[model samples]
Target: PARFEEGDTLVSWLAEIVGFSPSDTRLAREVPFMQDTSTGRPAGKIDLVVARVADTGLQWYGLEIQAVYFSGRGMQSEYEALQNDVDPYPPFPGAVRRPDWRSSSAKRLMPQLQIKVPTLRRWGSKLAVAVDGPFFESMGGPSSNPSRDLNDGDIIWMVPVLLPKERGGFLLSRGHWEVLTLEESSRKLLAAETVSRNAFEQTLLEKLKPLVRPTE
Candidate 1:
């Protein structure tokens, strides 16, 4: 539904980021959640943290805003092409481009969850993820399940409504959302059918054939 240079606009505006009342809410970014066991260096950081005071004590929620990354040639050529063209409108793409959903979800976000969620889960704090509608939908149907109750969920899925602007960007607005258990979200994000052993062996053999020289 939208693209952003960064998630700062949404994160800066109180209404856009947090669902709860803004009173006493504080924000932190790139928070370290885990440390390397061998090196003792910070291994992972939560992209954002929203903290507030509760009657019992300080309450904080983790937020991760995943921006879609594109897989294709660099945009330098497009910029170069636009420089000389007399036409008022921009030219079509020089190469095909598509969002790298798999890398974004499985490789990038999933690891953060795996390392951090165990701690947050223990503390009973919630992790909220902000992503566009289509991006989430591309996860192959994991996010389609009905949202669980807020308190019952370990993750809060926030999908913002982004309206087209006249110039080129988008206007962030209210959006659809739901809640789900970590187990459900994890399964959905990494959803893939298991292959049979024979099938795997065939694929492996096919891959090995090119690298191995023919036996004469």
Candidate 2:
């Protein structure tokens, strides 16, 4: 439905949402997510890079936004597949997956930055992903099922509705529901549009600030 640039926009917005400055951070722009030469797997890219500096230490952040639809397929699983550069054999396997942008980029950047800094490691890296989708039903809801176990990291499977107060505030989630009625979810999205946009911008600034280099 969209392109990679949309993912970049979302990452930029997310950094701003968490109180990062645009000027202070380093934006890698469109760093390529390279595929495995041998396996021909789908490698996802990192849309944004954030460098955070404190008196005690410095932190590098990687951000990615998943706007595509992966309802039946699990978000984490997709993440993992990209990180590993290996597609699932059966296809649509539900699991948590990480992105390979950090690992591959770090390896490539190490030699370049090592001459100046002399120290670089791939671990302890922080990654954040903003998923764009409707909510999924969790535990303790009306007609809830025991099999539907969703964690915080998991995305909501249902769409949101921003309806008038008379109608209802929002249609949160509907798990395993065959049909989706957008009327309610549309209203919810309308109400949340401003807040979502603002949050995204804030997150972008927050994550981008650290990557910005000092002026000469």
Candidate 3:
């Protein structure tokens, strides 16, 4: 996750799925777009672009992948605990930790979409996004983003079902697909629900107590 192996794995699979022979297919990584007005340099890069040499010309789709990131204690203790376990399957999570959905979705992934998707849309190329099940579910994608058999969306989401291999490990099987416009995707990324006025004031007052510091 730190080195973004997940992104690389998705890119490999995507190039294969482009369904062209190795000779005909070209893979572009860190493809730059969205030029900075002042610097006149590309401000962002699409994760990967899979291009195929067709009879007429080159055809490609932009790929962006978001993997779940965990926030909390390091996994070192968890690994140390697993070493002492006798069971075939060691108990997970010796420490308290959880997937940091808010940070990953709102802070990390949202900016990527906002930067890249619109430009791709303008260029008449669809943006294909690969996100894990938990990531998609966190966004309430099934309810908010419509599922379509037809390929109509400017941004296409490919959510995978992690199927455990017979031996060990897992395979990312294509499980779900959804399509959304740039606007819809933007709204979904802004997952913060509004707080009530009373709730807001109560939280505000609680924090303010520390700052007051016993007024003379």
Top model number, lDDT: 3
| Candidate 3 local lDDT, 1-216, one digit each (tens) | 333344355555555554556677677878877789999998878777888888878888887778787888887888788888888787866667889988888899888888777777777777888887788888876754365632456777777677788998776666677777777776777777799999999999888756457768
Q: Which is the leading candidate under TM-score?
A: 1
The sequence of per-residue lDDT tens digits that candidate 1 reaches over residues 56-151 is 787778888887778998879988999988975778888999888888887777776776676888997878887887778876533545664677
lDDT, candidate 2, 7-66, per-residue tens? 345444444534567665556644544566888774645555666575657655555443
Candidates in descending lDDT order: 3, 1, 2
| Model 2 CA deviation exceeding 4 Å by range | 1-9, 17-19, 30-44, 52-58, 70-122, 135-216
What's the lDDT for candidate 3? 0.74
Off by over 4 Å in 1: 1-19, 36-41, 78-90, 141-145, 165-169, 201-216
Report residue 121 deviation for candidate 3 (angstroms).
Answer: 1.2
Q: What TM-score would candidate 3 get against the native?
A: 0.74
TM-score of each: 0.76, 0.29, 0.74
Of the two candidates 2 and 3, the one with more favorable TM-score, higher being better, is 3
Worst 10 residues of 3 by lDDT: 1-10
TM-score result, candidate 1: 0.76
Model 2 scores what on Cα lDDT?
0.39
Worst 10 residues of 1 by lDDT: 1-10
